[model samples]
Target: MDEWLDQLANTLATTTLREIHSVLKRAIRQAQARDMVLRNVAALVTSPTGTDGRPSKALTRQQAEAVLKAAEVSELHAYVVISLTTGVRTEEARALRWDHVVAWIPSLKTWHPVTEVGFKHRKFAIHVWRADREGGDTKTRKSRRTLELPKLAAQALRQHHTRQAVLKLKAGEAWQDHQLVFCTSVGTPLNASNVRRAFRKITKRAGLGTAWSPRELRHSFVSIMSDQGVPIETIADLVGHAGTSVTEAVYRHQLRPVITKGAHTMNTIFGDSHHG
Candidate 1:
């Protein structure tokens, strides 16, 4: 079985091999539960590493700036901005809903959703609670975090809100109204292909070519934050990474970084031209 698994790993892509391995492991576990197997042998087998996949690439500060510039004219502009600035995974950004967006009212001394109170303040945030996962939750429950928005991201979302209104009017009775931050003309959720195809166009317009995807936007966020002298621990927390001490302690506060230092850093970095 080990030899056969190694041969399968060599024959398939790394992701494909991992998916097959997971399926087999779960199937064997199920069989054990049904008393059809004496032992879950699949769990005992170590899956061999397949060929290395594409090396992860992160955009430089200039490249990131260029992508934002190019994205300004596209419908996916807000999506690009949110992913790149907030370090959110593409799936999390896709699953973002209007209600999850909130603003801190200094006068009211509370955080109320933008959908409830409107984007009328300097402090805006996103509750990163959902993803395109099977149960519509983040990869791990602890990964759910609330991240403050830089002024640029807030402006982009505001503009996106207006754009979605336009789309709703055009669709009329056909609009589905899921209230997703990014969606189709009829208001349905966006699929991976839709996001990739649109993001590639933005990257190409930025002179980066078609190789870039929305996930790269997240990579760029990490790259930019790290390059600007932000602490590694803070970056890890902002990106919702697990197994870190920062994340471990953060849950006590629901992982809400007061003032969202990362967002402030981002605001200072891209805050020059995009602020206006």
Candidate 2:
């Protein structure tokens, strides 16, 4: 005989009230998109106290180590390695080619390649050499960034190249010329889903739980860098963020300690100890 929500809200716990409010808000937003609702009724309600809902969980360093160790013999190990170490997007790592590695001096350094891009050299390499390899567009103009590869990441790439060469020999003419760093048996671009499936298999076998995903690897990268006290601006630049503000907004929770540490550093630098 009475309004159901009014009856329920009168009897509902604070947490239940907040959740009901959230569900209604989402519904209203969807309805608003179709012009069925003029305003979000849930938005008008005051949120109940002390009910922020479930927190997101991320991998601890130990879990990451376990995953990487379990993935050791997999052909896709380099993908995990690059993701964990350098925060390179899965597509960018897959899209990488042998030519992307620039040798310092042609005759001297046989297998050694550096990734630091100088203005003149990048221009020359992009125009003359890298154009030959297919699959070159970065996700965004900002994503065309050059990051210094960690030592292990570079080593993994070297091993992957050798492995691919052997694969090419076995496949013979059947191997398509994808020039991709990661590929299927016949040298084709890997669909993102397939990689995730393989990744899940390895993680499950390793007992890492079903919660792990490729995006978690990227999140791990940000967390590790954040813990190391890397500046937000520098981290943003390394990770191809458009600006420090974006990085701060997205990673604010992860960077809280870094922010606190930065404040301390600034205070120490400007404090009376420095004023002779």
Candidate 3:
């Protein structure tokens, strides 16, 4: 089985190999349950690493700024803004509704409806409790979280809400009132493919030549926060990970070690001026 996997590895990507391995293991488990096999041999077989898959990439601060600027004028501006700034998964953002958006009214000292709150007197936030998956629940229980919106994200969302209202008036009875924050002009839900295509157009307009996807915006958020010295635990919570392990494993490349603090502390204590 290992030899067969090795042969297939030459023509497949690592992710594909892992999928095949998973299927085989399931089959073996079923066979064992049926008494057709004494044991699950597939579990003992290790999956061989296959051809390199497409490498994940995140935008630099300059590129992120450019992308945000370009997206601000695009039809998908709200989608881009919310995903990048809030670090919400693309599916979760697509599943978002107006009701899930809330505003913390400082004057009232409580959370209130975004529509009713005065923009200057409140802070906007998004509750990520659903997704575009089967059953509409989030990827994990821990993924259900509330994220505060940055000023830029809030501004984009406000403009988007106004634009959507206009679209609703134009559609009149033709509008499907899903109340989705990011949706078609007629208020229909957006699928992954539609978002991906739109995202590429936005990146192209921003002068990015490399292939990019909507999900990369979330990656950019993680990388930027990590580079700025945010702790892994905090990042995990922001990204809705069940634990730091998942965040570290999935975004290992984006994470920077926090070892600089110790060195800086030592340098300050000893008055060392030599650069490493």
Candidate 4:
């Protein structure tokens, strides 16, 4: 096992190595429980550090804008818009259903005519309740959140819905409605490869390199919000992070150092009262 791992070390990444080790150990443990093996030899094996993998990157504001503009005319426009604007994970977006898309109706202090209430006056929102994981739950319990859509995201989704309806009519009997917001032409669920290929095409049209992925839209969302000085706690909640620690760790590059807020507040209060 060590020899085989050593041979793969040059090509595999550290995280991949750890995952392989974990799977092997679990299999061995299960076999032992069934009395198939006298001892779990895989448990004795430790995960070795492997080659470094590609580093994650977040897009700049200009790049994000370019991508959004390029994707505007593409079939995946709404998918890209929601991912970038809401900081939703790609898996969650893929599993999203039209039923989960809601419009927030604000309460009026005084009675208003029913005719005055319309979709135009409502704020669009999405409930992140499911993903491509087992049991159809989000990555974590905290990941199930409701996010108010920005203008661009709302517009994109509205347009996409109209387009999908047209396609549904065109398909006729072939249209299988799983209610997915994003899906194949026949209304089947889209695989990761399908999304990756479409994303790469969109990036290429936007004059971006081939290295970009759908996941980076979420990263761009984090970076842009952080750059705009949104609070870490708020960003965490928006991105469906269990805590600020995960948000900070995963998006360390996107986060601006917050150390100066205290100094600035102190300066405002003290105003250089003491001499040097």
Candidate 5:
């Protein structure tokens, strides 16, 4: 079975391999907890093949605009905007509530909620916990950091609130106060798959190319910031990455332009013949 699994891992694309690795890691951890194993064997394992597989893609601005326009009529349109604009993961967006989001229009600032998440899984499944919105914490300690959204993202959220209120009035007694910024028809927590499906449909309708996904929206946000010359240190803080190193390791290829510009700046500043 181990050999077969190894072969399976080798055959998987990068994203799929990551998912498999995550599941294996979780099972290994559970076995360790049960005294079935002293160490996690999967943790000892390494990917020999590397990421010579399908790379993750970020959405183009035009594609993002189309998606935003298509989702305009969706009840959760604001949530989509916030996720895409701020680079917060879907789980982070889903976990947000009215209390968590603070809009200070006078200051032209919006603060994202920060909270700790305690869990036992090696890779906390974003989907399962999403099914029961109250079940898990944020994905990581780094993920507990706060972010300030740009003015546009905050405005979208405000409009979404007014729209949500209308839906609540329509649902009347059936509206459950789940405190979620994004909810189902009757205010229950939305199924993560359903939300993804809806977004995919919206993208298709808007003629966004095949590169968009819930996660890609986040990638796009980071990429846009990078293009705008936001420092990796600041980007790390904005997106809840542990450090600039982690951000670069994960997104270097996507931020190649930023990297090039940084190199150019260094060359310009220090390349001249001055004090030997």
Candidate 6:
């Protein structure tokens, strides 16, 4: 198996190798969960890092704006808004529950469920604590993070809440209460295919055609952040990678080696000495 795996490591691109490793690992974990295996031996193996593979596509800033504009009439509007702005994985977005949407109370200096407290002028955040994965954990420990919602996303969620309430009334007794942030009109959990089909429709409407995937929204997020001169390390944290190596390796093209945090920190400490 080691020799075969080594040969695969040599033959496959890095992204493909890592993805294969992940698939094998998750398969074993599920087997263990089902009591078919004693342990997840796949967890013991390190994911192979290889050279580049077929790189994924990301929407440019203009293209991303177009998608959002097109999503305005779609039920998936809030889903797309949050995914692109926060770089949340598709699974994470789908698994997001109402309880995790929180709002800060400046006067009380505490957080409350936005479902209960409602959105005001105060800051709001999403506790990225769960996913649709087995055992309901994020892909990695670092992937479990809290992020403040952008103003656009916050507004979308508020509007989405109103819209969902209307759906509940329309659904009547047929509605199921999974408390998911994103769900079907009948309140059933969303599957990948459903999201993909809806996303394609929105993309086609945006004049981007139907080939784009929902995951590309995440890639667009990383690209957009990198283009904004955010340090790779910060992008790594925001995207929930344990370190910057994956972010650097995966997004090398999107990261244009612009002014980094290193320069900003130095300038802050040195009073912009070079400018004089």
The best candidate in terms of TM-score: 4
> Is candidate 1 or 2 superior in TM-score?
1
TM-score of 3: 0.79
lDDT per model vs. reference: 0.82, 0.67, 0.85, 0.84, 0.69, 0.87
Ranking by lDDT: 6, 3, 4, 1, 5, 2
Q: TM-score each candidate.
A: 0.78, 0.62, 0.79, 0.84, 0.70, 0.75
Off by over 4 Å in 1: 1-12, 36-49, 130-142, 245-276
> If both were scored by TM-score, which would come out higher, candidate 2 or candidate 5?
5
lDDT of 5 by residue, 1-69 (tens): 356556776667656666777678888999999999999988776643434666667766777788889
lDDT of 2 by residue, 150-222 (tens): 6666666667767888999999999998666688889998888888888887688678776567766767788
**Would you list the rank order by TM-score, best first?**
4, 3, 1, 6, 5, 2
Candidate 5 worst ten-residue window by lDDT: 119-128
For candidate 6, write residues 1-276 as lDDT tens digits.
Answer: 455556787778976777787888888988988999998777777766666665678999999999999999999999999999999889889989898999999888987898788877568899885443556653555456988999999999999999999999999999999999999989999989999999999999999999888988989999999888787888988887768988888777777675566777787898756684
The sequence of per-residue lDDT tens digits that candidate 4 reaches over residues 136-206 is 55365544688888988888887888898899999999999898989999999999998999999999988
TM-score of 2: 0.62
Cα RMSD of predicted structure 2:
9.9
lDDT digits (tens) for residues 49-100 of candidate 3: 9999877788888999999898877899988988888888887899888877
- List the candidate 3 regions with Cα displacement exceeding 4 Å: 1-13, 16-51, 115-121, 130-143, 273-276
Pairwise TM-score winner, candidates 4 and 6: 4
**Residue 241 shift from truth in candidate 4, angstroms:** 1.4
Residue 55 of candidate 3: its Cα lDDT? Answer: 74
Candidate 1 local lDDT, 1-276, one digit each (tens): 788878887667787777878888988988988999999887888778888766557888898899999999999999999998998888789889999899999988878888889876889999895353444543555657899999999999999998898999999999998889989989999989988999899989999999977887777786677667676678777887654574334332222343578788897888878754
